[model samples]
Target: MYILQTVVVKQVLTEKMKRQLLLSYEEQKSQLQREYEQLRFEQKKAEKKYKNSKKESAQLYEKEMQKRLDKIQNIEFQVNQLSLLPLGSELKEQELQTMTEVNVGDRWSDIENEKTIIIKDGIIIDIR
Candidate 1:
C-alpha cells in the first residue's frame, strides 16, 4: 500500500541566500504599501459617492487598509530577524507531500518521523 507523508525542506543560509531573502521581503513590503495607497484612494472615492453613509464606508476601507499595514510591518520584522541569523543556519523552506510505499511490517516509529531534505547553494546536501 502507499500513503502520503509530509516532508520538510530546509535551506542552509549562505550570504547569497540571505541577500535574496532580504530583497524578497523588501519587495513584498513595497507591494503592500502600493495596495494600501490604492485602498486609500478607493476609500476617498467611496466617501464621495456615499455622502450620507461616508462614515461607514470610511470605516470599512480603513479596516482593509489596516490589514495591509499590519502585513507590511510583519515583513519588516521578519527582515530584521533574518539579518541577525548567522550564516549556514538551517531554515525551513517549505513542506511537501510525498507518497511512501508501506508494507505490513513497516516500522511505524520510523515512518512517523518526517524526512528532512537539506539544501545548500541550491544543491541537495543531505537527507535525514
Candidate 2:
C-alpha cells in the first residue's frame, strides 16, 4: 500500500507539471502574437506617412518647375522686346529726314500731323 500511494502521488505531480508547461507555452505564444500585430500596425502607419511625404515632395517639385518655366518665358519676352528696339530706332532715324515740315495753317493732312509713334509686336504705328 505504501508503494502504490507513492506512485500515485508521482503521477499527479507529473500531470501538474505538464499542464503548467503547456499554459506557459500558450502565454508566451499569445504575447508574441500581440507583439507581431503591434509591429504590423506600426509598419502600415509608417508606410502611409511615407507615401504622403512622397506626394508632397512631387507636388513641390512640379510647382518649382512651373515657376522656373514662367520666369524663363518672361525673360525671353524681355529679350525679344530689347532686340526689336534697336531695329525700330534705326528705321525711325532713316525716316527722320524724309518727314515733311508742315505749317500751322496747312491743309491738315493726316500723314504730316501724325507724331506720336508706338511699336507693338514688332509693328510700328503712328498715333496722333
Candidate 3:
C-alpha cells in the first residue's frame, strides 16, 4: 500500500545560504514596510473623506497596519538571529508531502525517522 507522509526539509546554513536567506528576509521587510505605509496613507485619506466615520475607519485600518508591522518586526528578529548564528547551522526550511510505499510488516518508527532531508547550497545532501 501507499500513503502520503509529511517530510521535513532542513537547510544547512553556509555562507552563501545565509546571505541568500538574509536577502530574502530584507525583501520581505521592504514589502511589508511598503504595505504598512500604504495602509497609513489610506487610513488618513479615509479619515479626511468621512469625518463622521473617522473613528471606525481608523480602527479598521490600524488593525491591518498593526498586522503588517508585526510581521516586519518578526522578520527583523529572524534576520538578527540568523546573522548571529555561525555557518553550518541547520534550519528547518519547510515541509513536503510525499508518497511512500508501505508493506504489511514495515516498521512505523523507521519510516518516521527517515523523513528528514538535509540541504546545503541549494542541493540535497542527506536523507535520514
Q: Which ten residues in a row have the lowest lDDT in candidate 1?
A: 41-50
Q: What is the C-alpha lDDT of each candidate?
A: 0.94, 0.44, 0.91
On lDDT, the leading prediction is 1
Ranking by lDDT: 1, 3, 2
7-110 per-residue lDDT for model 2 (tens digits) = 01011123343345346555655555565556556555656778857655555545655554565555556445544443223222222223354556656554
Clashing pairs in 1: none
Per-model tally of clashing residue pairs: 0, 0, 0
Q: Residue 3 in model 3: shift from native, Å?
A: 2.1
For candidate 1, the per-residue lDDT at 83 reads 83
Task: Return whichever of 2 and 3 wins on TM-score.
Answer: 3
Give the C-alpha miss distance for residue 110 in model 1, angstroms. 2.5
Q: In candidate 3, what are the lDDT values of residues 1-128, reduced to their tens digit?
A: 88889999999999999888889998999999999999999998998999999889999999999999899989989988998998998999899999999898899887776489999998999998
- Stretches of candidate 1 exceeding 4 Å from the true structure: none
lDDT of 3 at 5: 90
